[model samples]
Target: MCNGLLNPAQYREPQALADEHALIFARTWNFVGLLFEQEAGQHRGVKLGATSLIIQCDKQGRPRAFLNVCSHRHAQLCEQGVHRGPIRCPYHSWTYDREGIPAGIPQPQAFPEVIADKSAHRLKEFACETVGQFIFVRLSTDGPSLRDYLGPEYDFLLHASAGMNGLIDEFRQDVHANWKAVIENSLEGYHVPAVHNQTFMKVEGMERGHQAPVDTVQHPLHSSIDHPAAADWLVTFERKIAPKIGSWAWRFPHYTHHLIFPNLTVTSFLGYSFHIQRFEPSAVGITTVHSRTVSVGFTGQSPVGAKMVEQIYAESKSFTERVFAEDAAICRAVQQGLECAERPAVIGNGIEDRVLHFQRAYQRCMNPTSPPPPT
Candidate 1:
């Protein structure tokens, strides 16, 4: 068993939250959206802590990220959703190019200083990169590249991304809990029997008695669990239907859940479908959970197979949403308890080992000088 490194007060303290925003979120590669989702000349706004960014696809069909604020009047260029046309400021007719340089000025002659030195007036650009279909941005100008930051998980994400065709469902909800509490809840399966009894626990062949042993993989910055499919009705159904539907050639036959540091989770069942979730800290006690589900396409061009895949995707989305709602309720209760509790929580060695792994990573990031917690 591993003892928790983070104290209960850290979950609800204002200073601790601020420190996390600076030392953790700002320095890390934050997931923005999928590159395939953005069309050419389209831009979408996203937030990393207090920093707002615009992840846009250029005319050349390349992904770029820039500060959402315009150079002329510092007004927001785009709203939260997808927008087409140019990245023009609403306050003035100032337009920015793909490089975030001011390309069009309504009254250029009025400001000769900007005309002389346009580089000084350009919108602040940040580091952005893509791994397969995913797009990530870093607020700080300097840090490890996204690939290096992801370490061994880089190959896993690349393979998973290649299998995904497009998103089928997306939603965001505000959980009344600290971000750590929300993430910790997801890192462990200890609560599944209680919180997800009706949804996840009830999945065919996933019952407490019938489930296969989970294989855990731990990295310096990330962790994952792979639950091999049991030899039951569901596994048999997947084996028969997968090849018929022309699923990805490189797909897994098990359920795998991955946690990429600070607050991102990528989970898949049989590698044909994926659920990408991010727990973004909105405030000291509020977390915004952004979730989207994507599925592999039918390449065999069978109408019957396509129909089957659609039905499966629909059922998967419904089940995922139900489990998310249940987890949110439990996370809220955990946060409430943390606010009044005085002792540190203990972690188990079995199913909850990943939770302990996450806590250790959090501590290492927030306090680099601290020694590792004893196992």
Candidate 2:
């Protein structure tokens, strides 16, 4: 009769899921949208996995993030339109100031002072910090500052920003695969040679040449980040990936930051920058990815550099599309196999460690009060 059975122990403990998220998302900094694009008083909305938030700058131009809903009506304050005026919920017309205070309310006579508790009713806030063009937000009222949360990864972002005054171009790719699968692929570089073999994989593993990072989570099959040679086919390809570019990416819990969260990935070649977010759910493994891209040099750049950069970006986009198509095919197959119990259990190798780390983060955040997952 179509049992609709789910093996929770093997996947997660439902009760502990929220608590686990509190542990992970509460304390860890979440990457929000870029800070530079929005003008002073400008507001933007972002959805991270399941949580949706609206970000706005204070009078000082500093950025802040809060749950977009109004306290009284439980209606979204930030409408679909990005407005510069005070945030107002269309449902009841309740309004909040940029600092997230209850600035105004329609038909106020109905409520007494004790019920308003303006401070408590204001839009719920989370701690946030800005660096360069990026913004980082933490869910809990208490946690380490965004700077400390980044650890050594901060250096990687700084290095990527050295040359470009800011981002020049941006792009996002949508894939029909699980968010976990998409993130794990980003963390490991094992597929570069086999999957991206045509245009990019052809490059030599040298700075002067072309080679993507190798997947390091696993041993035996693991390889070091490609160090390329000049005048080689790889160098030519690297020019396409990004010439005069310093690259760095990190995989954190829930979402991974390229360079740094909020920075909007800036690949030096042609100044191509891409900022992305992915949402997932247990009921369905499919993930929805949203991306924003923009041209960095608001002032513009040299013709020679621009031409070569555009060429590289075009080729890179082609290669990225093909590789992701391959990943989607494989992940869909994996999901189908699991749903059907095609194989009772699957063993993981070193490369699979990234997935293992993801699961652990999920478990730690989920806090499944239930039994352990299937072996």
List the global CA lDDT of all models: 0.83, 0.51
Candidate 1 C-alpha lDDT tens digits along 267-300: 9877778899988888889999999998765567
lDDT of 2 by residue, 196-273 (tens): 566445533322223323332222111122222334544454565443433323211111234222112222222243
Alpha carbon lDDT at 282, candidate 1: 89
Per-residue lDDT, model 1, residue 292, is 91
Model 1, C-alpha of 233: deviation from truth (Å): 3.2
